[model samples]
Target: MSLCFFDYGYSLLLRHTTEEAIATCIEAIEPARAALTSQLRNTVINDLIEGLTKHDWFTELDIADEPPPVRFSLREWINQAKEVQATVFIAEKQEALVKESWEVLKQNIPENSLRFFTLVLEIAPAVKNMFSFLKDSDEIPQNNPKLKAHAVKVFKMTCESAIQLRQKGEVVVSDTTLKYLGSVHVEKGVIDPHFQVVKEALMRTVKEAVGDQKWSDEMGSAWGEAYDQLAAAIKTEMKQQLEAAPKSSSD
Candidate 1:
């Protein structure tokens, strides 16, 4: 970007942040967090922060009593992005740790799938009503082929979406996958609480798959955060579908 644009943007940010100026400047760029590629967004924000010290007006925004040093959080723009859950910036190390554990998780997918569904049922037996495969049989859901297949498919989709999240800067799955998720949840009458139950079960299942020796609080957090992002994407689609459906007669 041109230096002129950078200076202008930085001035706008200063005004909005310190001066509490009108939100027009900040509002205009909010969409950039979701629309712009991560690399571009990072480049723009980083350039703005890095050039702060070079500006003659740097002292104006600086709050430190001492000179020659400046301290701030991960940059205000980044904080803003995180607040909006848009283009979230994941550290390289955290991203790598998740990627590594994900590979190990794959080895346990079959066994883990059984355990995941078992936990889901155990956590909320009411959830069983939503599973069509369980309607015709007395067999344990974990043992049923249909349950196993569906469980594994869902586990893969949810976890895989989480895995790629670091690169995508958001939870994004194939449009086909999104459509399937949106439709099934609508058909099953799934709600936010159901998603929470499944999320807890998924967390417990992942912990078991990784085993005690390998599992850590950080891993739990990473998986939980990723799952929330994925769930939010699905819910957004579901909301749209529900809104678009023909309204019932209440007139």
Candidate 2:
């Protein structure tokens, strides 16, 4: 969490600072050297950067500052800020879209989970067999209690992971969860093809839940991309299990 804040600190510093602060900073210490620690300067200079930043260094402006290069360079800073703003803009929008859709799903877990699995089977009927717990006797997920339980768990995991992608920027799967998922996937013969089927079904289910009013290309893309990261994590663990298992040799 602190690390995320640390990263954002750099972006905020560049995106928010004014040309005045830039000029002041350059005039005080050549970007490469600090007045307080420079060998050429035996005496300490004013901490204008700190004071200006805390007081009014970043008094939100409609137009960005275009600072002329002094002894220091502004090219890199300007370029980096532009890149950071573009990336951050996408991440922030995704987080909002994910949270907005997730709220609806959270409100009615059984209904949404049922809808999700129904889409899965509709997309690929054979995919239903992958769920050993569902059994051949179960016609569809609507009447199956296990389907709802499993669906809720999986759907919740997906949304939570998607929601936190920008907040934490990485998946933090536990050892136990990894082992459990790998074992189940191995038993079900789950592979990339099956994963793709489920991913599509999920995207469809989320779109249906959110409705056309809130749904958009960007929202779908956000969920799809986040799920891709999560599916990668699961696949990595499953690959390890497959490699570690003993194989039968030609006799």
Candidate 3:
């Protein structure tokens, strides 16, 4: 059987009580499997039979000219179902943490963004040259209209990227935006080293905004993973675009 079938069967088992009901649902969904062939159907049936046996959901009955007896173990099925439930419960808890922390962070986008840029510049002063608006300023100026606008835009983009990463399994989040951003940054001479600086700056900003009492290690990990994915996508596209561009006369 295909991994898809196993996944579907596992999902059904997670929702239903009886193995028979699960089997019925699986068979019922056969019509929706697109171009399913007889051989594939048989394979799926065989896989189900094997899975049921492995999970101790089978029984044998003595009869003439009939299929063998198959006993279903309710206790075993319930145990397996609980495992799936536990996984889902943990995922939901993590998602809730991210959302809750994000709500607090969004309340002060401008402040957090300022903190982010300030931290970045403090860690890597040379990066300041990349920002034209801050060229004449030695420090991240507070309440500068241009700085505030830039910060707000960056914060919003960060939030959007995180949300897309969080829901990636359920929905398709195109990397086109990130790719374009990467290309633009590359044109401005931004390189890979800047990514780590941005990540550190953003993490510090988030921690300061949300407070240590509310932020957990899991939340930090989730945010890190999300940013890493976004950064990687951007860097990859940037490299691809740079490679495709014609070499300058200097090169």
Taking the tens digit of each residue's C-alpha lDDT, what string does model 2 give over 79-162? 445555567567767877887888887888778877887887888788777777665754674777788888888777777777
Q: Write the per-residue lDDT of candidate 1 for residues 1-251, one digit (tens) a residue.
A: 44446457867688657544436555676445434544565666666655653564444345478887665544454454444333345443446667777898899788887788888888888778788888665546556888899889888888888888876568869889898899889999999998999899888988877788988887887888889989999999899889999988996
Candidate 2 at residue 1, lDDT? 42
After TM-score superposition, the amount by which residue 60's alpha carbon in candidate 2 deviates from its true location, in angstroms, is 29
Report lDDT (Cα) of residue 198, candidate 2.
81
For all candidates in order, the CA lDDT equals 0.75, 0.71, 0.70
Poorly placed runs, candidate 2 (over 4 Å): 1-77, 133-135
Task: Report the Cα lDDT for candidate 1.
Answer: 0.75
Of the candidates shown, which would achieve the greatest TM-score relative to the real structure? 2
- For model 3, how does the per-residue alpha-carbon lDDT over 170-236 read when each residue is reduced to its tens digit? 2123667756787788878887788898888888887888888887788887678777877777777
The estimated TM-scores of all candidates read 0.66, 0.67, 0.63
Model 3 pairs in collision: 58-71, 59-69, 59-70, 59-71, 60-69, 61-69
